[model samples]
Target chain A: MANVPKLSDPQSELLDKVDVFIFDCDGVIWRGDSLIDGIAETLERLRKAGKKMFFVTNNSTKSRAGYKKKFDGLGLTDVPAEEIFSSSFAAAAYLEQSNFPTDGSKKVYVIGEVGIGEELDLIGIPHLGGPADNDKVANMGSGGRLEVDPDVGAVIVGFDRDVNYYKIQYAQLCINEGDAEFIATNLDAVTHLTDAQEWAGNGSMVGAIRGCTGQEPTVVGKPSPLMIEYLESKYGMDRSRICMVGDRLDTDVLFGTDNGLKSLLVLSGVTSEEKLLSPDNSITPDFYADDINAFFASETATV
Target chain B: MANVPKLSDPQSELLDKVDVFIFDCDGVIWRGDSLIDGIAETLERLRKAGKKMFFVTNNSTKSRAGYKKKFDGLGLTDVPAEEIFSSSFAAAAYLEQSNFPTDGSKKVYVIGEVGIGEELDLIGIPHLGGPADNDKVANMGSGGRLEVDPDVGAVIVGFDRDVNYYKIQYAQLCINEGDAEFIATNLDAVTHLTDAQEWAGNGSMVGAIRGCTGQEPTVVGKPSPLMIEYLESKYGMDRSRICMVGDRLDTDVLFGTDNGLKSLLVLSGVTSEEKLLSPDNSITPDFYADDINAFFASETATV
Candidate 1:
């Protein structure tokens, strides 16, 4: 029994020790479309207390700008686009920082949604595939090769509702035959489709490509130091004063601890309390709470 | 260096020691639609010598009858439909032997091609989702649950060029939530699209479902003894008199050795001599040949 502190009061000493708060959107702020109980008010309170807040999500289906619209739709209008860091944006940022091919001689072959394309477009990187290739099917019956675009220098894979055999085969060909670099936006296994259901995530799509190519992709999501390193270099934030809050033990909590920051686990999303307290569980969070609502719970309430 | 005997003479002692010859189709007999030179004549001679033969292919894209068509097309008209054993047919055979839900109570859900569906139809097993679900897309934007057919008792995944996210997600839902059994036809990493090209196989599609469900499937392909055990019981063959021949070291040679049978490697397809003789390679074949044609080459020619 690890004695993990429960942050049940607004004036908890752990809250005063942190100057910056990083939150995961799906489970912490909202599950699917609906907002979490008092998460909006909790953010406003934290903002009033002079704490800087940023939302980091592994969902690559949306860019940072797209995530801003989602926040607004959930009535969290105060959350700005600049404070959001999505895996889609991280992939583009990673490529831009690494000096990826900028010339028209080579382009990225995307096996994902439009958000990845939009992010690449913002960075002025030429790319093809994505939603456009969703309906495409390979002519396997013809006993001919699927034409590999010689200009493809990289294959960026992310979450896609329209993932098909064409994209999987094309990505495999690009990486195995075209000698293209493989990049994955995230590797989260299952994602919340709604408050009660879980669906296959981008990791499943990436696994298919990995199976055939027999190569591992450079993952750019949580638990990977890519995004956090970008945030540190861009904002110059002190790692010791930053606290990460999320519902997943593998991605959210591991991301914070692996980067030498504090993490808080919430029981509102995918992970249940029983799973966290299980004897075999090794990922220990700095703090645990019923939900983000517990952060502002009255001191007179249950300890 | 380990001594792996090279078979060059038709009167090699190894040939007389074996009564049954199980061959892999793509690389041993042919590469794509083009049959290897003298392979048809070699089979005819082997039959004349009273050696029983069977074509065992991990290619689940076609059923036994479909493979017979390919054999006839390649001028191997003496090869009967019963002699062809495809992974698709093996999947159905595996389920039938296990006495899978024979009544109308539950059905198998297929995440593969028409071949798998056809094989299931042959065994009088009701199934859905194969080529029929190829064009289906998940309504991910709505954040609604993808309907899981409660009638699905098992999910049989094989090679499918029409594999899409809908099938992956649907299979995941059925296996994880609906408690359906997971069955994989084969786990071969790649398959020949043409002699010059290779594409992602059913293993990659199976990998996607395994990724989300976190479950291992009962693989019914090469290297697994399920098909070999079925053959042994059905035909009452002696294991000591069986020889497995193929081009791959992982599936073909491993399959034979794992099942206590002599294995022969042919260099007409994927594995090259360098790879086979590599110091780090652990899978050693009982015999190696340049191609099937080398089996009948004159002893005085080179060896």
Candidate 2:
């Protein structure tokens, strides 16, 4: 058998060429509520080394302002708001630039809370369902009234607390009857939190509609070209020089691998060693590290 | 607008009689960590009313034993292990019965964990990726230097944490190179936890591979006729009398709609109101309730 190169034993030479370090929060920096070991020191050390580092988190729960507060609380004050990228921001920016057909009367049915809803408003997209909207609806099989907005033009799938069967059914009817385009904030199926385990991300919601309508959605989050394009436009870095680091392989590593960038998988969060060794792996990281501190200390100077 | 018939509205009196009550676990009974209010009491009430209720969660994370423990913890002690139906069990039973082209020497690349993996082992399917097997090497990725089992017959997709790009690429290669049939445990896009959000279910993982290989998978989960058939065979109930209850409209409600059964959507979980009103709505539930308890208490009982 030929000696095929495994990522675990990276030729040591490929490790030195990274220029931009894209860090995924939640898993790499902090799992849920607490910071990973030596993550703050790792960021400071990387900043001192003059590496162009940015925080790329797919979590849409918090806005950039919230992230800034989280970073400051975690002792990562060097990075500014502009250096942080979130799916919420990317979704908003993509909507702004996207040439999808929209009518002044057309409504964007949003399923998210303040952050995602606010982003749609900021982009001048008209939305239908929200806290104040009287013409509210819910999915079928959920035991809610199906209030169909006949004038709806698009369905934007986001995270929400009050989702129901009536809501899903109404969304389906719109797609089937209105021929509306669909967009999801992200394809992440689950979000990892501080205290609890993982929950469904936009992908789950997207899957439901897609399965029913047989239409794929235009995703605008991590690993999606939209988020990456937004980041590249702002950061002015070649895609090849950027590396995506996180604890889970599907989102972070898959994002990096899909975009032809290096992925570094850390063992400090959601994914375990048993998963890494499974035969059904769909995402493979370019590099594997114990923690961000070790990755920064060992690979920073080399890169 | 002429009174639009609200299929999900309990007050609409769409369902006058109850036949079979199918339940999904994640959001309807409980969101992530705890049970939704009034679920046990409602189930008990419905049980006392002599309704045929079956707990049918699509989550492949746990087995019958695991779900039994969870249901017992919730104090719904009326159900037995035989009542639960998981995707893994469905896949295992299907593979066991359908004379799938396994020559005993044919290698099987298992993409999921214990739920799916253990089932394959129990069915005498030769696994290729474990430590003990070298003759038929199984890995997450399809492209590799290892001895590609010449007798490889099928590529399986399951809920795997170790999934990576290489694994998908490898699976694609195996299918293209060896002409192996592609099979998936389920097409769930997200799995829910109580407190956290959703995680990428097997659907997205399969999508990544399908994007490359241009091959669709043979799915074995809810909404798949195989599962419905298996249930019908085991339970001996008329398919028309079954009512599927879940949080998301895409899977649970759609399953019912597609199979000519009644579907109920619960607000205690993933599907949201905005989604139902969106132009893209597809899967409309037959009925809706704030939660399972409300279904029985409200007009859902007679309607």
Instruction: Write model 1 residue lDDT over A163-280, tens digit each, in one string.
Output: 8878888898889888899999988778875544678988788888877888889988887888768878888988988888899898899899999998999999889888888877
Best by TM-score: 1
lDDT of 2 by residue, A114-185 (tens): 556666665567776643432343321333234477777777776543443334555666776576778777
Tell me the native contact fraction for each prediction. 0.58, 0.00
Q: TM-scores for chain B, in order?
A: 0.92, 0.77
Model 2, B205-258: lDDT tens per residue?
565446445567888777687767776787787877678888877778888888
How accurate locally, in lDDT, is each candidate?
Answer: 0.85, 0.64
TM-score of each: 0.92, 0.48
Scanning candidate 1 chain A in windows of ten residues, the lowest lDDT window is A1-10
lDDT of 1 by residue, B1-303 (tens): 456767755466567788998999888898777899889988987898898899998888888889889999999999998888899998999998888877767899998887888898887889989999877877765656788889998999998887877888889889988979999998877887655578887768988887788888998988789877887889999898898999989789989999999889999988988888888789988889888666567743665
Looking at model 2, residue B92 earns an lDDT score of 66
- Candidate 2 CAPRI-style tier: incorrect
Best by DockQ: 1
